[model samples]
Target: MAQLSDDCFAFGGPLMSIDDAVGIITAKVSAVTETETLPLIAADGRILAGDIAAPLPLPPFTNSAVDGYAVRASDLPAEGEATFVVTGRVPAGSAAATPVPAAHAVRIFTGAPMPGGADTVFMQEDVRVDEDGRVVLPAGLKPGANVRPAGEDMANGVVALRAGQRMRPQHVAVAAAFGLTSLAVRRRIRVAVFSTGDELASPGASRAPAQLYDSNRFMLMAMLKRLGCGVSDLGIFSDERAPLAASLREVASQHDLLLTTGGVSTGEEDHVKAAVESVGSLVLWRMAIKPGRPVAMGIISGTPFIGLPGNPVASFVTFVHVVRPTVLALAGALPEALTPKPVRAAFSYKKKAGRREYVRVSLRSAADGSFEAVKFPREGAGLLSSLIETDGLAELGEDITKVEPGQSVGFLSYAELI
Candidate 1:
């Protein structure tokens, strides 16, 4: 549904910073124009098509915030305990039968509506019931201390959830509370995914001694599904320019976006760049990031295309850093959710200047009760096991050359990305 810009790689030449790349994507990609109405139960993880305004205030009435005695603060003794006649009882889901009079208290339960003249509540434990049907109160109590004002959670006619928001269980609960049986959400994104390499074989299938089972495609499929895309796996394509070109054009015509892992590098077997260029145009390639330097962004017949690296770790890292935001932008949500967070580094490390790096790291509990990121024991784009073992990636910026222990650094969690 989104189109690529003509000068997507105009800034900072061929190898661009992560911020610049994301900026171009955020600016060029337009949200899908289609929408659908679905039942509230079916709207989980779907982007909201329109803003949800509160039909009426939440709770709808002023009520007690605790199980206690509701009484007018003015009726209580200023500095000592006092006894009040028990006038009436009001439990949750029931209204007060009569107005609370001075020197009288109403037995109220949590969520019960406050009596007409009662402005404060004393917890049941703080009060004692005498044999004469009177309640003895404590010396000190704040006015309106245990009261839930009308519309406390939400105000009437206010927007409870804005458009482009992904609906979660709590959001569904709000919709249910507003008596909405259904909601309007953006239609699912249509994605076509494939892998490129003669040495890659399908998982669980027979493979040659030199060939390896393709894990990147399955990982891409799962990631796309988690992002709420309607994915179509196009299987694997060999290193053939003509066939791959024809397939790219055909798939682009049928899907909103085409995603492939491998064949962007300048090698003899790499044909994806050539194919995409022959059919459409190559907008950008070669990001300034470690393990994902070969990532490519382009367009085919008005459909956006992203070519990830062949290595599983590179594919995973690039998808989280680059492709994930592009897909979210196409889905009508703001692509700012994946921004990096700050964390402390437990292990000291050194990196070259002018290239950003994401190191797989596990979180360690420090003696001072704070979290520190420790790099994984192993390294390499081919070692996919590191991803499974690490809690997240510790990001070192292009300007940062060295990190000492306990130093604050940026962190990107796999839990948040997926």
Candidate 2:
């Protein structure tokens, strides 16, 4: 793991913009140097450690894209249908025994390699066979039609995948097409996740009168897993300054990141800020965002640590904006910025200027035939139901203070946040 300087994330502003926060993490943090090779089957979600060059051209051979009659373009009549002798047949796995000659058509099935001297094809449905046993090809059937030239999809030796790319199923398919069984990928980032607060108790545990189940820890771990992180669930640490500080130091050596869900704010009960500072260093990030303004970015024993807000919604939102990019940087992956699609707002909203806000919204079909965003009825960061019932979020920029029905808004689906 790469260690950042103490001042790398240091900012003078009272409230940092989300973009500025992301930029600092991306620009200052260095990726871990370790990598591993895994079979392409298990490589999905892993980052590419190096470029993948195509071993051979896609398709590898010139073939027919459909069941057709292959013919030489020189033999076709320009203004009318032409009759030709059917000389040979080519199935997907079989080849023409001899080169197709001029003035002759060869029966070719989909995926069959095109025979030599044949530069065009006429779909079997578009031609007819007369009683004389000669096949007729239609006029204006352009030359080279229906023929899939070798390397048409991608040429040999081309860079098929680049370094720092997260492998999707489509990328795996491409690698398989190139006859590759495995790929070199960066190892999953090791992260230690926990929650902080004396009032919190682990789920399924006997709860005290003032205690609530620790939901943020489990939520953060799940989110980290989606990012291909090797997560160690450290459970909860009570709001004790000394004990919390000791635990943070103990785990810092084993993980690339230490993430806590609470105790980052300036409240007296918040020990995460002081704990981190005692162990190593801390930078309180008063981010200019809704539901997650009090974020903490720090370093403990050279490992990066981030403390998100305690509320469930705040934790979820801050994790998406803060911990996400930090993890990507550590894994050597390219920055995956979330881009919201434009949708019509069906509800009115008001927010302060200079602070970004994400409104939970479900999309519905509108009379105009386009998708419109409908806001959730209730509000509060603690309501987990809001996240479950919503399809995505409507992003209100820092400059915007209000919204009206039919206004254009940027919406981000939950599917792409990771």
Candidate 3:
């Protein structure tokens, strides 16, 4: 946990750029102090505590890439077909007892180790077997056609996975291939979530006049869960200072990060910002991004605080673009692994130059063998239907004043980020 200075909230200057704001939040994030050793089966989606070096080569031996006959590449006929005696058969997991001599071949199956004195494999389909178990090479047969050299996949003593690498299914499989039963992984960050507003009620609750059911919490929780975080739900908070302040202080010391929706703006009823200021420092108040402009980032008694907008889409967008990366960094993941590559925009839209905009759009392939993006009809921050119909956000940069049709722009896919 890291604390923000009181000078963080004193400035009333222009709203910070999205990049600068992200830098500030990430700079204040502290890595978690906990760690755990988990079995390979439980290591998926966890961050590696240290680099993993290969103890043995991936295949561990030179092997055949196809079911074929192993022979020395120099022994093959230069012009046409050649004949050889098939001395023995070697399937996978069995070692060749005798070395394959010149002008002789050994029947080998896929994954079977290459015999000594043999450096090439001819596919079984390209050869004819005579009654006496002789192999006849076909015309145009090339040497080394199907041999897989040892250490081609991985060499011993090589770094298989780097420290701070987030484990995926493929990573687990690689570790298992090296006979690793377990891995040292950083503990998942514990996060507590709540939404603050008098007009906000939980979904399925009766709504009074001018009241709207809270949707940000559910969306935030889903995003956090997808990021492999341990989440605690605090439901909704009222507009008063006592309960809100008490709740903030109580949960601050218990979790690595505290996330809330609403109550950070300058509205009269907004108390979350004030409560945070009294207990901690609000590092950032606003960003130059559309829909999620009211985003706030701060530190409370060493625990990081993220305040998202109450709007359903805004909360989700901000979480994906900003808080998601911050949480990942705090969990000890590499910075490059946090954000995804910007995809080329499929469709064109309009926006002002100074501020960044993220438009929800669906992606489909065009007849010209490229992705054609189609924007959703509704762009409201509170409309859940817009997100339902879109695949992800098309990030319009802060430089371009106008975008014309057929021009490529940056896009962020939901499947990639979430």
Candidate number with greatest TM-score: 2
TM-score of 3: 0.94
Expressed as tens digits, the lDDT of each residue in 1-418 for candidate 2 is 6687887877776788999988888888889889998988999999999998989998899999999899999888779889999999999998888999989999999999999999898999999999998998878988899999999999999998999998899999999999999999998989998887778889898999998988888888999999999999988777799998899899999989988877787888777888899989888888999989988898888888888888899889889988899899999998887999999999999999999999999999998799999999999999999999999889999999999999999999999897
Q: Higher lDDT: candidate 2 or 3?
A: 2
TM-score of each: 0.96, 0.97, 0.94
State model 2's lDDT.
0.91
Candidate 2 minimal-lDDT segment of 10 residues: 5-14
- Candidate 3: where are CA atoms >4 Å away? 1-12, 139-142, 337-348
Q: After superposition, how far is residue 259 of candidate 2 from its true place, in Å?
A: 0.6
Q: Which ten residues in a row have the lowest lDDT in candidate 3?
A: 2-11
- Runs in model 2 lying further than 4 Å from the true structure: none
RMSD of each candidate relative to the true structure: 1.7, 1.2, 2.1
Candidates arranged by TM-score, highest first: 2, 1, 3
- Residue-by-residue lDDT tens digits, candidate 3, 1-418: 4344445434357777778777766775667757899989899988899999999997889999999899988888778888899898899999899899889999999999999999889888888988887899875756667888888999999999988888889999999999999999999998999988788889889999999888788888888988888999999888888778888988988888899888898777789988887877785567888879998777777777889987888888888778888887788888754343444455557787788888888888777777766788765898999888888777777897666668776767788887
Backbone clashes in model 2: 0
